[model samples]
Target: MKINDILTLYDKILIGFVIILSLILLLIPFYYFGSPAEGEELILKVQQGDELIKTVAVADSYDEPIVFEVEGPIGIHTIEVNQGRVRVQEAPADDPLKICEKTGWVDREGPIIVCVPNSLSLWLESTNSDIDGMSW
Candidate 1:
């Protein structure tokens, strides 16, 4: 078949649209869309019952996991921090759900590790100093 007959007007327009869309999709990641910057300053905040227990800067390298035992409502609970990530290493026996321990390493900001049985929680947050408000 002749090229003209194979690619009609409508077919050409559709092909052009598809090519443009594919190119835009391919280049979207190259244009910064204001996603939270990776490897930025990440702060780990450990809280218990509305009180800020401890704050630590997440480190890239660690000899071993930093372990913390905090007394909670149920009993002693264990928290582990390693390589800019935090997770509940162990939860109290009273925690029937055991959801806290089940929640794996939390490396990004926004996710919170809460041990309901122990009234303990931890979260990673970005220090606003490096984060510009214009990132929208």
Candidate 2:
């Protein structure tokens, strides 16, 4: 009935070890996947399927939004880049879901906005040569 009667000394030790291991696993991802956006020279990459369309340095973007159109399988996608952020300003009219437009602005790397209907994608890239894909 009581915890002492139900669990032996070995049982308590095993439970403690599991808790410690669980915490280590939980914290490992946070340590490895830290946000590297700070002071990063972010470059916005626009792509349609496997083809790379264009890349622009976020810092070099003007105060006035830089608008460009990319032709995809479906139609045209208007993308806006400004103030170290980029977004799909307008998706093809054929896209009823308008998922790309709804994705809003991406200010940092890691989060990718995709338009599967149009085969279009946008994401930020860190230009630091020192950083590897996975620093072991």
Candidate 3:
């Protein structure tokens, strides 16, 4: 109605927003940074661009190499995992660089290998690690 009334309403909305934002900030640490449960295992996650493709247990002992075929815009790319290690075994010939295949093997957490042309990526993750680092 009046200018003063509109200003008062705006103040109320601003206070409500501040209160909600503060609550979210206070609760974020508990939800986002909580300690991992006991006996947590290591895992390897595969993705095509932003989409998640697969998750494999990195701690498990595999009898043979696990092959993962990831299809993207370029073509199909192959990823292999064995004995707690992961490698980009093969990529489409057209990709040329083959950087993902050249990345060799990654066993520990925190390393990520990506095939840019294929839009494929892989990362090693571990909930239980001696080093306190960020992984996601």
Cα lDDT tens digits for candidate 2, 37-84: 456688999888799989988887766778899987789999999888
Computed on alpha carbons, the lDDT of every model, listed in order, comes to: 0.78, 0.84, 0.80
Best by lDDT: 2
lDDT of 1: 0.78
Model 1, 1-136: lDDT tens per residue?
7899778899999999999999999888556533347546778898999899988777642666788788877888788889768888888888899999999888766668888767788987786545343322
Off by over 4 Å in 1: 1-39, 129-136
- Clashing pairs in model 2? none
Clashing pairs in 1: none
- Evaluated against the true structure, the overall lDDT of model 3 is 0.80
Model 1 shows how many backbone clashes?
Answer: 0
The digit string of per-residue lDDT tens for model 3 on 1-33 reads 776766777798998999999999999966644
> Per-residue lDDT for 38 in model 2?
54
